[model samples]
Target: MALRLLLDSADPSAWAEWLPTGLFRGVTTNPTLLRRAAQPCNLEHLAELTARALELGAEELHLQAWGADLLGCGRALAQLAPGRIWVKLPITRAGAAAARALIAEGCPVTFTACYEPAQVLLAVALGADYIAPYLGRISDLGRDGHANLTRMQRIVESVRRVDPDGPGDRPDASPPLRLLVASLRSPNDLALLAAEGLDTFTISPDIATALFAVEPTLAAAAQFERDAEDT
Candidate 1:
């Protein structure tokens, strides 16, 4: 599959800045991001936020469910934009239960906070739409984050071979569980992880900006403009 990028932020300003670029497939948000953006965690605020994201050209929105009643929150988030919303749940027992129920009800689910390779099995078995692993956070724990993420991607690819209509093979079939890697620290991490065969990513605005900050590239663009102006 081709590389898919999602803007990881609750701030509409970020969405407005990047979404219109047509590079990001969507936007991903959790309670912490909402808090960081000074947005309320309640459904009322999320409804407004979702509308704003869509207005800014976000094709999809991954809204995370919080608190004890994950299923309830997932259901509400799913209703926000119907096919456009993908409810995010933690990859825990409770989250699995919630994801199972949500998936059963036809709500696309993304299992989040995935720290171990074994957790990918849960997402696969449950037929989730996506599983997110925090790469930089894993590295912060003194583990080899790139190696662990590659293992997770391998598990995701291995599952595709079992079914005739699995990920990256059939376009009309049910979507397979995708490894949406998150918590990227630098622009270089994109190339590093992509080299490991990982595709989907959720990046912060700073990283997004850095992706276009190469000095040589900027100089080339300036020279092109100067040539055009000279003509």
Candidate 2:
């Protein structure tokens, strides 16, 4: 399939306006973005936001666990209606446990905050459909985030099973783990990942908007309109 462009925003208006464009694969949101969008309902506000996405015919609706502890995560998970929610989890001991429990129940999970091959491998072992490595966050620490993701991609590809000692299931041919690179900083960051052949990304609303408004593309469209008018 083509590269999946997803909006990583939680605003209800953003979803209502953007989903109709048919450019976004779906929406992905966290506690921070949702709070910025509106008063955080201890995540209770997400139900209406999700309903809006579904009403607009979204393909996927990804949400993050509001709390750090397993209980808190579970509480956050309970508020969401379960059609297409992929709960994002940390790689902590409690988080991994929650992810495995959810995975076993046939629920989709995206293991977030990953920064290394080990974490990526762990998510793959848990059968997480998506593993998100925070890109700009890693760069903030003066580390090479792209290099780290390269290593993660290698590790994900080498794994022969979804869960080696746990789920004990054979990995599918479609690549057991899908990388959803997060925390994008700019349009160049999006171009960088696309040039490197990465397929999925969770981009901020501003960046996603900027992506469709590049100078060259806009210029070409204007020229096409002018030529058609002359014709």
Q: Give candidate 2 misplaced runs (Cα > 4 Å).
A: 68-79, 160-175
- In model 2, how large is the Cα lDDT of residue 185? 93
Lowest lDDT 10-mer window, candidate 2? 166-175
Task: Please provide, for model 1 over 100-207, each residue's C-alpha lDDT reduced to its tens digit, 9 standing for 90 to 100.
Answer: 899888888999999999999989889898999999999999999999999999888887877666544677655877899999999888899999899899999999
C-alpha root-mean-square deviation, candidate 2: 3.1
RMSD of each: 1.8, 3.1
Clash count of each predicted structure? 0, 0
Clashing pairs in 2: none
Tens digit of per-residue lDDT, candidate 2, span 24-61: 88888887887788747455567777778878878888
Candidate 1, run of 10 with poorest lDDT: 165-174
Best by lDDT: 1
